[model samples]
Target: MNHNEYMMKKLYEEIIERVGVGIHAVNQEGKTIIYNKKMREMEAMDKEDVLHKDVRDVFRFQENQSSTLLKSLQNGEEIVNVKQTYFNNRGVEITTVNNTFPLTMDGEISAAVEIATDVTRMERLMRQNLRQTKTDFTFNHIIGKSSEIKEVIALAKRATRTNSNVLIIGETGTGKELFAQSIHAESDRSDSPFITQNCAALPDTLIEGILFGTTKGAFTGAIDSPGLFEQAQGGTILLDELNSLNISLQAKLLRVLQERKVRRIGGSKEIPIDVRVIATVNEDPIDAISNNRLRKDLYYRLAVVTLFIPPLRERYEDIPVLIKEFIQKYNELFKLNVKSVSNVVLQFFEAQSWPGNVRELEHVIEASMNLVNYEQVIEFDHLPYQYRKSEVKMAASSPEFTESMEETMGLTDQLALFEKQTIEHYLHKHHSHITNTAIALGISRQSLQYRMKRLDIRVQKI
Candidate 1:
């Protein structure tokens, strides 16, 4: 061959060797002639085995009757840009988008060039993006923004990126489920199901069946069923209050986590499962383990990463924000144009210890919005009588408590009580400086002044 022709052949060979697309040349007899480096790599095959192999023997799929590429090849027509799924030698699934065109020589088909692009990674990413787009997630989906809540969110974000187990601990109404959802939403497996089950909510036998699945007729009325773990395959299953589960159940769960497989109850077959576990508990699992409520080994397995959420009292600054959000939500829900809570009501909200945390605050707002008049500011009267009585009792029970001063009282009695107490406390504490008081309280000076009037807390200096 001439040097120019040799150089041209060398250039084409290099392109086939280095190009990202898997290239294969098949003669008119449908036997592979040229299998490039990429094709070999994608199929996990060596050059020798692929060079003389039949294309059909190396690739299999359900027959497509109207397949353009196959039809074109048979009719000596050119085909291009056809996508198909092909199996490799070891039966691993590979997705390839390709173009197949008949090679023409002397006005006759001599061979065909099949250019296949492996799109498995691209397809997986697209699926992930699509799932994220469809996910219904928002800040309100979580309950609080306290420093503790923020820390939990940060930890959850980090944990989701990895395949580690996570344990979230908090009291009831403290949004343990919210942490679970946030982790799932931030994970690579976010596209998968984020299933949850309260261990305390199920019986031991049923819980076992629900988690590890069951075969048809395993027991009376126990038909074929996939458990929470199976349903959460390629995703996460949040076992809330995992410490509450029985020790026997913990053993099964530990096995699932360690072996990455689960046997259906009353069934001999062990099914493989791939799922991320993010469990939550109100009690410390370590404490549970110490008390024998949870197995020590299982606790260690689940506690690969531990996160804690502080009670609302620790994050009191978030109370006002949470109250505002709750009010707005209930306002729309109850069809009330409730403007805002009076300073008297707000002070009562902030001062009282919330045993139920954000949940208690939400209920208070929801109850007030339903009972308040349209476009009217909610005052102590709009608040539940129990809450108002409790606040009064708490205020009276304090050292500087004033009592029996307003018998047969009206709005003026409440105004006088607030102005004399709440405002007096801040003014005295900050030397009558609104800016200093607001700063100490972590609120805007304007908001502090607003509270002054709403509570009828007068600036004796102003």
Candidate 2:
């Protein structure tokens, strides 16, 4: 070869190696000819492992039916932007978006080239960014006027004044995350990154790496990476359902909290991090402790500024305001002009126990709005099937009854039966909790116990 030809070949090889994407090419005979540097990095393979080998032999194509390069070479076709996920021979999973096409010369198939973009990091970063954006919530966005809710909001607002870790306790669908975000937004570190993770969403090994980071060579295919704690430095990290984390991992988290430092998995150095942590638990902390789902030390560390949000049933006075706000929200979202809910519908909403709390109420309103047919008012029929069934049950259990019941009983007898049914309904709704059932019934615990004894009500624990 001439000197210029040698330099030109060198330049082509350099350009292929320097390109951002991973490039692999196979000759017309389907033998691997080019495996560039980026391709080696993405696949965690060396050039010696792939170069000059048959493409089918290198990838073990007999094991995978979706080899785009082989298909492109065999069919002389092009495939673009196809996402593929596969496990390598080492059992490490790799995900990539690929473009494969036949290299044509003089109207004849000469070779096939495959370009792959590793999207694993990009996808993880995108999810982290999405979690960060959820910190847009603030105190102003919290929708409630009842005294109990106001009290919780007041406590949460006080919590934002300091950098102490916080623990928010509430039942499912009670907007615990909303309170957490509001606290973060109101805090001194409001301008910094706010990251969130659901502890239950991932297995322990993955969740640990995601929370504490991982060092390169921590395990096979583990890259040196910053976890959520590092990503949330100088800001806040909200760990939802913190009790869902295993005890061993909880111990590690507690160490991080106490020391304000995190050590990456399989690394020796401890890195300092300055972040406010806010954790949430759907169940009662006592229950979590008793069930061994949460560590007592971790609980104490996290509950430095504990905030307990009342359930919707306990804050019944907020129902009308919440309904109005939800209606306005759905009106804007659905592009409808629903002005109000019928009085009967409002009564049904107030009387029914909202086990799913505020979230359920929002969903019910959204469903009703969808079924309203441009009507200004949401009627009984517009409610969800569950709510409709509730309305029927309420009507059937009311003091006024059907002709069949009247034919069998007198007024006094009917009144006694209705009273018994009401007590039983409240008991079942409150999960047979005597105190809560009494509170809902507008009676003292002693009075409720007396009624239960007199009425032969057998309270069974749920």
Candidate 3:
């Protein structure tokens, strides 16, 4: 070869090395002929290790799975964007998306060339997300066995069988997202992405761009990237707090649902989507429409299959079970061995209204557990001040009991008793932080310490 041919050949080699993609080729014998630099890095092998080596001997392929490259060469066909997982020379797992083509010379197959993009990270992330979706939002998360919740969960399970849109209606903290996630995990698209976007979290000005995506220069700081809809292709996209979106944005979302396509903000091209939409409303859909917070058109579109999650107050029978679940959770979390709540405390938990739903009940248990140390039973007195203040008063009848009758001790003793309870509760609330607790009690650090000693309240762990 002349100098010009050698130079041209050298230039081609350099271009292939820096192309940022993995390229590999093999002869009809299935021996590696060309392995680019990117391919070596992706496979964690050197050129010397791969070149002239049989793919079957170098890579670990399962006995059942077909090799896309060999398949293409055998059929003289092209396989596009196919994923392959195999162990490399160093026994490291590798994943790649490949476009394999059969090279032809004189109307006969000569070799096979494979263009690959390493997707090991993407694959792992997708699997991690799938695990999280299943783990964090399974039927087990319901943590209740009441008929109201059971009925709703049954409906949700049926909703998962179709690709139709779902609208979950419930009050706040009633586990709307939990049902959405459970449905996604049980659906046909379980292997794909499960993205959640709260309509309230999106800015009004950029809601369009964020939901539909934006092209570079569409607006200041706009990026040429896939939006939530595109990113959740072949999976589920959960629109949380659906009523928080304005009517105009709701209209755009309805259009996307109706057309099954999305156009980026300020862009003319439309991209088709195959995503299962699950929207949540933290209020009655009828109330939202009447209040002008939600559009009726959007509601009708999203509520193809509507589900209502009953609040924890309505599931009174589930309180004891919920309390047990929370205790077990805190046992694992706080590294304690708390076993149960006292019978009276259980009665109190069941009687009161949990306006915040199951979440409020959980919080009460968590806070009460923090006050315990190696204790097996949680009592009413062990609960947070808000809960026990009433319970203690009702039980004790009054703060008149003292070590002695002690004439003229009535009002002063009563005031001291109130002060003692207030200081102790504030200390625990602030996690034994002297400065913060003092601030909360509107007293100085020295005064708090003096009061603690005078009231015989022991100092807890800092």
Could you give candidate 3's per-residue lDDT for residues 1-462 as a string of tens digits? 999999999999889888888989999988989899999989888899989988888888756876788888889999876678888867788887788999999999989999987767545544443444332577767777777789998999999889999999988888899899999988898988888777886467645655787765565334465677887889998999999998889999999999999998868899999999999999989999999999999999999999998876566678889999999999999999999998667767754556788888999999999899777999766889987676546336534444463344543454456557777788889998989987886554655665677578886896
| Pairs clashing within candidate 2 | none
Flag the better candidate by lDDT, 1 or 2. 2
Query: In candidate 1, what are the lDDT values of residues 1-462, reduced to their tens digit?
Result: 999999999998898899877887888777788898887887788887667777667666655523334455668766554556656667776766566788788988888777776655434433443343223553347656556567776776777678899888887777777777777787787777767777887678667877787775565334456777777788877788887899888888899899999899879988899888888878776688788888888778888998887666556667777877787788778777776787667666755557787787888888877677655688887787799787667556645444554455544455456545755787888889988877776555655665566556766674
Q: Model 1 segments beyond 4 Å from truth?
A: 1-140, 143-145, 395-462
Flag regions of model 2 displaced more than 4 Å.
1-126, 129-134, 393-400, 404-462
- Model 3 lDDT vs. the true structure? 0.80
Question: How many backbone collisions does model 2 have?
Answer: 0
lDDT of each candidate versus the true structure: 0.72, 0.83, 0.80
- Number of backbone collisions per candidate, in order? 0, 0, 0
lDDT by residue (1-462, candidate 2, tens digit) is 999999999999999999988999999888889999998888888888888887656563324456788789889999876666665556566677778999889999989999987756534653664467447688898888877889999999999899999999998999999999999898889888888889988778678888998776665445567888888889999999998999999999999999999999999999999999999999999999999999999999999999998878777668888999999998888899999988767756655567798999999999999898878998888998987886557557685678788788754455456657888999999999999988998754655675566568899878
* TM match of model 3 to true structure: 0.57
Q: All candidates: CA RMSD in angstroms?
A: 21.8, 12.5, 13.6
* Candidate 1: residue 207 Cα off by (Å): 1.5
